[model samples]
Target: MTFRTRFAPSPTGPLHLGHAYSALIAAQEARAHGGEFLLRIEDIDQSRSRTHWEDQIYDDLAWLGLSWPRPVMRQSERTKAYARAVAQLTDAGLTYPCICRRADIEAAAGAPQEGVPQFGPDGRIYPGTCRARVFPESQDHAIRLNMAKAVEGLTELSFVEKGALFAGAHRLDAARLVETIGDIILVRKGMAASYHLAVVVDDAEQGITQVTRGADLWEATQIHVLLQRLLGLSTPDYHHHDLIRDDAGKRLAKRDDARAIATYRADGATPEDVIEMVGLTP
Candidate 1:
């Protein structure tokens, strides 16, 4: 199989050093292996995703001396595909409508009898208050995967981590996924699909053979692997690298205007200079 990878950026804000690092790493990996590198616009959050940002993404990537295959995949346009996946999950009895909101789930998860509050991949673990309930058709609610039920007959899981430090086919810590990443959301009531659902679907559709990203998303890989299994999609090998930090010892954010790629370029920084800034150049 061709070792394909992507530099998917959510067109919500300006691209920062962190974004550049991830994109360059993925592009380099694809080039090193004589594979394809694609660019995906993850504009699932329509409210925050702007046309200006999308335009800026193209400008910045081109300025960085990178290019991808034509007809870039945008998550917003792939709602129909995501909807079909959700429908399949609904048919398999692995999903249930979640009526509990963030506050409600947090309160329930933090209840005294609920034991030491365990946080999952999505931050706090969902308390599953609506797991067993049968809500009316008119009820607006998110759809959550039943973690325990989802892994019912599955055997022990393992995935390849091709990062610098965590390389090889590593066995999954099932206990941690069970305890920390329980009942993840697939689709919100008003939204077409959540990140977990849409990303897995997009990766599979794009034939992403290798997923290169930051280590911050390591735990999220567990959920992605599970979804790939459940959906019968090919699981891609992952490369989670170290994150680029700012002077404050914090991860770079899009909101950090000073660190935005556009700002640097406006200040007469070249593509090679930016690459060096992110330590991508030797």
Candidate 2:
């Protein structure tokens, strides 16, 4: 199969130094391996997604001297596809509708127990209060994966990591997943699909052979792998690179306008300068 990778960005804010580094890295790796680099617009959150911000993403990436094929994939247009995947999982009894709000989850979890993880990649691991509840037809609700059911009968789960720090074969403990990352959200209350579900389905549809992103997301890889297996989809190799942080050591976020690519470009910085700033060759 031809090597393929993608740089998927949410068009809710400016592209900062971190975004530049990720996009450049993926593009560079694609060239090095004679593969194809693709761009994806993760605009699933329509409330925050803006046309101006989406246009800026294109301008910023192009200004950095990176190129991808036209008619790029956008998450906004893939709701039907996401819905179909959710239906398949639901039909297999691996999913349930949840009406628990953040406050509800916190209250249900109560105090943190000894040796029990309270937080996970999906944030405050779900308490499974609604796991046994039937889907309410008239009430708005989110969809959650039935973690125990999803991992049933699985002997072992593992994935290959080609990152700089943790480069090796990694295995996941099924029992641990049930304790920590319990019943992650497959679809949010008002969204078509949550990041976990949409990403897994999108990667499979794009035929992405490799996934390149920041190391901060390493913890979430196991979730994606499990989803791939449950959906009968292919799991791509992953490259989790280091993140770009500010002087204070905090990772750059969209709010860091000073580190935004547009800011650097306006201050007379060239594409080569931006590339070098991210520790990449021009």
Q: Clashing residue pairs in candidate 1, if any?
A: 120-180
Tell me, by TM-score, which candidate is best: 2
Off by over 4 Å in 2: none
Q: Provide the clashing-pair count of each candidate structure.
A: 1, 0
TM-score per candidate, in order?
Answer: 0.96, 0.98
Write candidate 2's Cα lDDT for 220-270 as tens digits. Answer: 999999999999998899999999999999999999999999999999999
RMSD of each: 1.6, 0.9
Cα lDDT of all candidates, in order?
0.89, 0.93
Worst 10 residues of 2 by lDDT: 129-138
Candidate 1 least-lDDT 10 residues? 109-118
For 136-198, candidate 1 gives per-residue lDDT tens digits of 968888899998888877876778999986787877665666677888899977788999999
TM-score of candidate 1 versus the correct structure, residues matched by position? 0.96
lDDT of 2 at 183: 93
